[model samples]
Target: MNLSSSLMACLALAPLAQGARLSDRLESAHGRFLDDRRGAFTSLSDPFGVPPLAKIVLEDPRGRFSGPESWHRNVVSTVFWVGELPSENNPTPNTASAWDGNWQANFGGYDHPEKRDGFLPTGFVPALNPFYIALPYNDIGRDGRHRPEASTVIPWFWEDYRGEGISVCKDRWVAIHHEGRVCYAQWEDVGPFETDHFQYVFGKDAPRPNRNQNAGIDLSPAVRDFLGLRSGESVEWRFTHDREVPAGPWRDWSPEPGLPRR
Candidate 1:
């Protein structure tokens, strides 16, 4: 079957697999798996109930403190080109070039440096300590009803410093936040530390209170030269944590056979 047909099949079968309704299943599943115990700085809040784009602007100009609602509705919308659907009034872009143009117009001109002011917004106080923003994306799935391939994109943001620049890091763990709960796909072996330190490149254009080192790395000149990462090039750090695999669904998946479990 074609992709559309396959997706239709999945959607059709979704309601028949369990005793609960779809909404109930989703709520139950999310409740069982999501974690929300990080503290009062982590923005592990729900995004589904957020007001629509128009309503948000009208309701709160500064946004009621930075969180996933700000990230998805504002940041993602500002950065990515949300495509139009096929409807009576809208026509889809024909080629990748057309789409690229739309995307560029949507995000290219925004003052990213201004937006990167001190990680979270200035006035917004976090609700959880050791706050983390988990970004999860499907690397292998197409737009429609195909089973996603074995690929994952998991990035995290942790507040390690007490300054404006928020220290963002990439970990091997699959971080997920659903229904006010967070879940982590623990890695068998921790990966290298990858940090995102792009705020320092804009010179005076960079954000203020630049004394913090957690957000930006002080890499050696030789290493910087080797990587072709210029002074202002956006850089990110990645690191691994030492933790044993929990006995659960992922017990069999290991970095290697007979390797010491991290």
Candidate 2:
């Protein structure tokens, strides 16, 4: 089925998706997604270039259509995710404890090393992103122990697109809205579980629960405090790019994103 068809099936299939495993749903829909992390949608292209209602396209089988798409100001994306953060162990703990020291072995959560210097602002809460969220595995993967870090930033998963989703490395901007509050954050890492859910992350497909948890998105400590988010808190977040981002507490921390960089 095409992207349109998949969306059409969403409302009807949403009920069935509850308590469903990621693999089971994919197998049932005959949906062809890139399972292994060898080569997911890591292209450094303008994800918004592809217009939703356009006619021509060129992408892989699972629908990454690569022609000239549209530039929608407000992308049709609002993910319903349980806010998760990089804590000490698997199935993230309710509150934060000490780093336990193992930063790279088990839940590896690192951000863009290139723009790492000025990533966080002065007196930034949680001190720094506490984990190493590198490639292949964005967030601390499921069933692993992670010793958190203070000077280092913990991973927060994001889309790999410019001007639409993740614009720069850890410098990408995002507006996280929960309850009545709207907080700005950087696109730092990925996955609370099931790392390769591009269809739901980038695309407008309804957000689904992870196999181990229902966490569709994870927030850094700064974001959690600003938004007053408790553990297992529900939130609605979207890719805010550069310009669309408002002038607020998060704007001054790092250099602005969106324009082509050197």
Candidate 3:
């Protein structure tokens, strides 16, 4: 997102006003640029004789967005812990992940957001990054066989795939947006309900119907706390490149056990 020169100029001078109704003052300053002549001052709203501010409209500078920003908007998300017990909606305990059998053991303990020690479970620090998420697609099937469409459906499957036992989707970064806050997390497991929904996960199709309020993704305790998200909430998410993920708590810990922080 880029800002116009006039709008940028007004925002750059926002700190000039310093009293009551701060938002109104800022708005007044912003309004000046929109209402007044191009690069010209009109009225004295403050001691500096600067015009009132104008409304700032955020937009793409090129009038069109790039193709890669395929965000899954307004998708229902649910909270799931590393060692969560089995529930009615989720029949399997999260102790064992679809990829890693020793998921809970590898994570160090149950990642209880309510009983936490700063984004991790109380008692022990996780061996890997606590910031994790589960999309509704697993490249590997339950029968210990890889999905036939995995290579074609997954965007970077060919470049990242190691072998049969390994998963390319595991540890993939995802950016989740709620309201105005954005939280980044790694893909560690699969399912709020369905997996193998390649159309929704990779293409333009929406999520499939499910019992858990049509949940499309599963968030970890760390991700939940970071975004201030409830168990059942709507959020927008998109797959993000590892290098593109900005420095945050999500990068504070290692993605692999014994490896350096990512």
Q: Specify the highest-TM-score model's number.
A: 3
lDDT (Cα, tens digit) per residue for candidate 2, span 30-72: 4333221113445725433564565753322212222222111
Ranking by lDDT: 3, 2, 1
True lDDT of residue 14, candidate 1: 48
* Predicted candidate 1 versus true structure: per-residue lDDT over 51-79, tens digit per residue: 54663322222221223332211111001
lDDT of 3 by residue, 213-247 (tens): 88899998888888998988999998877556787
Give the least accurate 10-residue stretch of model 1, judged by summed lDDT: 72-81
| Candidate 1 Cα errors over 4 Å, as ranges | 1-119, 126-137, 140-148, 151-236, 242-262
CA shift of 136, model 1, Å: 11
Superposed on all Cα atoms, model 3 deviates from the true structure by an RMSD in Å of 21.3
Where in model 2 is the C-alpha error above 4 Å? 1-170, 206-208, 256-262
Clashes of 3: 10
Q: Candidate 2 has what TM-score?
A: 0.39
Each candidate's root-mean-square deviation in Å? 28.2, 25.1, 21.3
